[model samples]
Target: MTGARPRNRKELLAAAAAGLFARDGFHNVGVGDVAAAGGVTASALYRHFQNKQDVLGHVLLTGVDELADRLRAAVSGLADDPGRRLDPLLLAAAEVSVERRELTALWRWQGRHMREADQKDLRTRVGSLLTDWLAGLRALRPGLDPGQTQLLCFATLSVFGSVGDHRATPGAGFAELLARLARAVVGVDLPTARPSSDQWRTRVAPPPSRREELLTAATRLFREHGFHAVSVDDIGAATGIAGPSVYRHFAGKSELLLAASRRMADRLTLGLEDALATATDPADALGRLARSYVDTVLRSDDLIAVYTTELANLPERDGRELRAMQRGYVAEWVRLLRSVSPGLDEAEARVVVHAALTIVNDIPRTARFADRPGLAAELTALTGAVLDAGATQP
Candidate 1:
């Protein structure tokens, strides 16, 4: 029998590592596993990569490079027609997102595992891509201020990137669907009224004891730094306690992560229940849920960040349970969306829901707009537009 043609070992190894890291997370996957997946010995893998971190950096940076190149090709000749350029730009983004679904997960969650220098380089490259998009957006909407334009750019990227958040396979026209949703995001009329002082009030009470203090500190640390990067001593220092003293309140770092994640999950569940209880109709319920979600994110941004990005660091059982809760929450939104617009199929509703949620989840994390006046209102409006785009689609 004729043997298959040999492939480049380095490319094979990177591909294998990307899939494993995206699926199992960086901390969970070992170098030997990556080597096995690539059909190579550990020694052979070591010849190409310094370590697993090196593999991860290669995977993530390569993905970024590919995206930047795709985007460049997307708008090659449309420089003068910034308004018309957005369609092709969005389509190109959607195409790449579908082709490399693993990239979204790697870029968002796995980058934190990289060394400091690599992480900075990654951000700079990604920022350059954003800057190019921002210039297009500025020309497309000359009336909008810099802040508004940047926010829209971020939201548009989030819509395309949201694909990695779920596994639901939509039928034909998936890329076009994402493009349409992104177009809606680009056209959103952000609200301008500054939020009143009372609107900024947080519902979370101050830590009532040393244990609560430690949990609070841990959540912040984990959000700012990856869970693996932070130590029990760091959490203790934040709360003025010794490293060993933290054990009295929580079993270990893992327990602290679980507790913090549980707190976030519980708050989201409660918000969902409240939205359901008071809504008079399906549309009303969705609107309520959107506003409630924005409020929750604004009030507990750090915890929300930790809850979403640090799940892979949690104990396996806790991760599964929290993931189920997350699914239930998303399912409720899908149900309400379908009821509101029976025209949308199940797959379409799920995709649109993810897009809207991603807009809210991602836009606020951008430092420029995180504390902007009336941000919550703008996010709520943008989210509504995303959902409306789905409802009106043929």
Candidate 2:
């Protein structure tokens, strides 16, 4: 089926590869799958990309180029003022959430699996776009330092990327909703003083059972190296066990992933339930939940990372059950937010909830705030700002 025009054929192959990589993990999809998806034979696909890695690099690098180009084009015709230009630039980005959903997801998930040199190239390209955004944002908010500007830019991007990860369709108004939420993220005032860290504590803990030790080791490896890249023996080595000792604790690597993912989900579900018990009202309950989430993420980032990224590697039945539990956790947040903001519809509340969670999830990765004082308070305030932004949408 090698029927595409010579010029368009490469693009068709790249597009097919992006969709396949986004739908299935990059490690899971093979050159044959991409060739099949693009309506071409393996030989034809190779003419465009040297191999599957090459295909991934092409999709990711080009996708980043297009995203930056969209932001640039969004402001090209507008006034030179940064504040005046930001609206259209953001709206254009939000529109991409719908138009280029697969490409967006590819940038977020598949880029992580690239080879070292490819990963460096991808980061450099993404960093350049982020610098451009910071330049404009600094112009608008001269009070913000480069760190704050970078955080805001990444947070805003995360909001748009959330559309690809979820099934929510807020009718046709999703773009506007995303734009509003993103603008709120950008408009947030970063804290100047380092937050107080007295409340943050580390536990001096004892040893765990062999099964628990294996799960812990698996979670860290899966977070660092991806799920498919790590093997049962890798988990065993990480736990100081030899050879097939890992098998006694778990059926296989997938079961270890499922255990780590389910543990994270259960912690979140249980933590929120515990917070709601003593809340004075819905607002307090939401605030408590937000703080608890930030603390948990800050402490167990590896677990959270694996839970977010590696759950798809689980067997279909296990993956389905885990995802159901996750959705229920998010649904609890939706219920609490709706209680606090009665005017927020289900979709609006869900978007805001995700925006808030996105901040918690992405901010810690920056590493700047990982050891900063008042981290929880700052994140909680940012979450509030996102929720407040959603409130003004209607």
Candidate 3:
């Protein structure tokens, strides 16, 4: 069904494609689907974009443009008062979060489908926005080193990005709540030095087997390159085996993805069990959960990345099972959060839990911050702050 014709076909197509790609995933959406959604013919879409990938590039860049313009206007004429700038900046970001709910998802997962040059451009533009934020934050808190300031900026971005992860109806003061949480992240006190004993550095010995090596190699390749971009041959080469040899251990690339995804789910489940078994109370349980999560993500970020972004590539049944497992894990967090703070409703607790987890997942994957000393401790503190702020929301 063709809808009303848009005033500008290009913008309309990009917006339509963004929503579709964000909801259904890039690999699942086709050029005709985008054209129909935009209320235009396929030929007309071709006039604007060369292909589906081109449409995706336009959608992502357009979102980045909106963010840059809005943030620039939000902080206009407030350079002298750097402390006051963050409030309007964050508020503007919150507005984008609500208005363009698909943006974060597009940037996080779908952009991997783009060519490397396009991806680099996207990163550069987004990096400029983050640089602006880092300047403002550094001005307000001069004591923070470069790494700490950058980490805070990334965490703040994650707080706003978390909105796209769920479909729960926002409560009253939703934007205000997000801004407050971002502010809390910005104000977190980071550690000045790495811990004397770095647990993340301790590596386990690799299992001795061809199949295990193939699985390990496949997960990393899938993480580095999107699932559709990698192949059985690529996975085999990484393990010094022929492409056909990969099938001996796994039936196909799909099987490798399913195996890698299940590995991630199993690790998270084990972490939760560990957290539950050791905690004395709900609050303690939540803290242990957060710490366990940070540790898990830090140690196995490639697995986490593959699990999060490659869900669309899994077989239907496996996808459903993994997603259900994910929901159950999140439910446990929500349950513990509500127990810790009886005032928080289920929806509120869920949003808060997502924001906290997003920070943990996102910050450690960031290249600059990933290798920094004391990141785990700082992340745990930031997680606590997010939970504390959400728990006491008035």
Candidate 4:
């Protein structure tokens, strides 16, 4: 009997590596595992890739190339009118995000694993793509400076990046939601404001528990410096404790990271359940959920940041637990969305939920939107638009 045709080893390895890297993280997956996933020997994998880092560079840079290509296609028919191209460019971005889930995740989370030269090359290509986008944005919104345009571009892209974080099956409605949020992020004007006198007045509250203090300090340090770069000593220094004293409340730095991850996950999980319990209908439930999400994010931005960006440092068992909690929380949103729009399957609902979550996590990071009046309202409205878009026709 004739045997089945053999696969192209190079392409197969790339695909296998992308999935593994996206799931287990670049640092967590070994070369041998990638080769096995590709149904090849380690020697065969070596013949194709110089090393694991080479595979990583390919996975991430390929995604960037696809994005740049999509943007090029998006703007080709604009008749030399770059300003009018922003909308289509963003739409193209969302389309690619839907089409390439594992690659997108690698693009978002695995870049730091690349060598400096590879990172620079990727940055150059990405910068070129953004330069084209900025030209369009600048023409349309002359009041917005280059700095503001850059931040807005990132905020918009973050919505697409959410696809990598979950198993979301984005449809046309989900794409529309992403596009709408992208426009809002780039165009919304922040009102000028100052802190109230009450903010300036110092009122000391009771000291936190030692565990709370360590958790608080770790969250902040991890957010600013990343997990691997910040040491136990650094966390202790921030908390005004001896480096080894931290072991009294936690086992190690990984434990602190786990705590930070669990804190955000548990908070969202509980808050979402509470919100759902009190709502009159699907819409009300979603609205309450959105508001509560914004509150959790604003109050715990540092923790949220760590959980999303630094959980790769956690031990396998802890990571699995935190991820399960996160998935459970997301499932609640998926259920509520399904309730509101019976046409939406769990997959579509997941994409919309993640898109909304991305908007909340990202908009706050934009310096242009910082210290703006009605910050919470603005975030709620953007998130609501994503949810509402999914319910409406595409």
Candidate 5:
């Protein structure tokens, strides 16, 4: 009856765990929650997963299977040209990313808690996946290394993940974002901005601020690179502070994480509060809010990454508050949308608002104007359009 029936049971557990994790977060969801959702006991869940992390490990591995299968099939439908295949693969990957955002976030979140071995395995699988996909892209691109390729790859799938995380419309403008990622990765000569030795010493960045410099620098570094990819020394070096001195400012990277998260949560709620007060109407409010959000995102290509990737690393209480803050923001948006429509009840309004917010939240993923000659205005127009639709008078 129980001959290692982990895959089937595991998929159910993963799906259930993903729902709860996405609903709350990793730290909030216990083994019992996952087991209950899967209609099994915690003991049963443990059989497939050593712990919550094992659930995430399966989600990640499942993503590889699902995305690779989808990409391979989707790529077949595209023209042989590398540029053409890029979009199709991106579309397929984006779809999967949206469908899988919760687990994807978990997979990302695990960077905080998973053992070093699990983390290494995850990296290896990811690199192998990209190396294979990049092989298809190799004929079109030359001279790109794994580092560059990996960044571009992360940028590609991440856009969709953001869309899903933020709730982008299933079909709206997804293709455009895909095109942008493809073009940016291939068409643009985006040479990494390496400073000369003297320049590195001069212009890389100033020494850490005397006032909360260590914390600020660490947050920026973790956000700019990644929690796993960055180190305490990197933060210290960036800010011209002592690595050990980081302890004076904060307990460790995890504590620093909560601080960064608190900053974001404060901003999110504050922004929403301010936006609502000034808004003339719900739609105007939504547009203004969406505009502000997009503006922030455009300036911060790494903003969503900070929210999605590192939030999990924060200590438990802080992470809960941040999630609550986000929920409140979304809930506020939904309430405003309902006021605008009057036609939809609260639940219906939430459905509509969430769908729209998802798209608005996805600007960083799909926006290409930053690189496009006149694309900024185009992106602005698109941003306005979504806000308008969400905010438009009934």
Candidate 6:
């Protein structure tokens, strides 16, 4: 009898490694596990990749290459006129995000893991792609400055990446939402009365920050308005302190943004950890985490808003660290999901957790269209129910 053809060892190993990396992360996933997943020997995997890091390098380059290709194809037909060509590209990019969220997640994970040299190389590749992307954009929309164009590009990619295929309707996906974001970038009215740094600095005051005074005041202002909307002036004004003086206590708005986001995430994290540590029943941890995440996000729609929109732009070291913290936040949830659902593989559970987190983060947008109070509660409920169901089932 003829034996069945052997699977392509290289292709199978790479795919398995990508899945494992996406699931367990760079530090946790082992090459042995990946090789096993591919039904191959560890040596066979080693033949293709030196180690797990090499697997990550491969995953990173592959994802970026796909994005570059999609972007290139998005504009190739435009050749000359970009304006008309742009609408399709935007829509197409969104479709890619929807269809390829796994790859998208891998890209995000790898970027977070990237070292300086890797980052530089990826940036160069992206830069080249963006130059071409811009050419396409310029053809479509003439007379935009490099600054303005760059802003549009930056904002579009950020919002689009998270939200890509999401949204309930035609108006919700990347292209549609992107058009609005693009319009906002190009058309939103900047306040004519801008405060000078000194003026802002003077208006701010140093806080005698104990936890309650800091978080209560900070949360109220940030949650009510937004990160950018509520500047140093607003924070000080909220605390009944002079604006500039506020800088003495907390560095700037970015820190404040991360602080507010972390506060919410921290509460949920602590709650989940405590629940896991204290609970007698192993079955309840996933439910507890789902409740923890939902409650924390809905408690302050403003916090979720900043978490989704502004935290991405925070200053360095702080930004990187906060992101890793955010990952930890979700990872705990994923860990619980894996425990509760035997049918769901670790990698599959991770994808579910990510989708749940995205929905939670995007709560602000949902509130904008619907009732903030009611929808917030409803969504939190819906999220808990869904995750619980996911946990109970597979």
What tens-digit string does per-residue lDDT give for candidate 3 at 119-209?
A: 8988888776666677777788888878788788889889998887886556677787788888889888776666654564765876669
Minimal lDDT window, size 10, model 3? 191-200
Off by over 4 Å in 3: 1-7, 77-79, 204-207
Tell me the spans in candidate 5 whose CA falls farther than 4 Å from its real position: 1-208, 224-231, 251-255, 299-304, 344-377, 387-394
Give the per-residue Cα lDDT of candidate 5 at 39: 89
Off by over 4 Å in 4: 1-14, 35-51, 76-87, 138-152, 170-210, 221-234, 237-242, 277-280, 309-321, 366-374
After TM-score superposition, the amount by which residue 135's alpha carbon in candidate 4 deviates from its true location, in angstroms, is: 3.2
Candidate 4 on 122-197: residue-level lDDT in tens?
9898886666666666666778755555555565677788888786555556666667656666666633333342
Report the candidate with higher lDDT, 2 versus 5.
2
The residue-level lDDT of candidate 2 at 29 comes to 88
Give the residue spans of candidate 6 off by over 4 A.
1-7, 77-79, 139-144, 163-394
lDDT of 1 by residue, 135-247 (tens): 77887888999888888888988998899888766878788889999999999898875768326664576647998889889998987777988999999999998999999
Residue-wise C-alpha lDDT for candidate 6, range 203-262, written one tens digit per residue:
556765554355566656654443434677777777777878777777777666667777
Clashes of each: 0, 2, 0, 0, 7, 18
Residue pairs of candidate 5 with colliding backbone atoms: 166-358, 167-358, 168-358, 168-359, 208-239, 283-391, 369-375
Candidates in order, TM-scores: namely 0.94, 0.90, 0.94, 0.78, 0.54, 0.49
Write model 5 residue lDDT over 175-205, tens digit each, in one string: 4443443334344343444334112123466
lDDT of each: 0.86, 0.80, 0.84, 0.76, 0.58, 0.58
Model 1 misplaced regions, further than 4 Å: 1-7, 77-79, 201-208
Off by over 4 Å in 2: 1-6, 74-80, 192-201, 207-210
Q: Give the TM-score of candidate 1.
A: 0.94
Cα-lDDT of candidate 6: 0.58
Which number leads on lDDT? Answer: 1
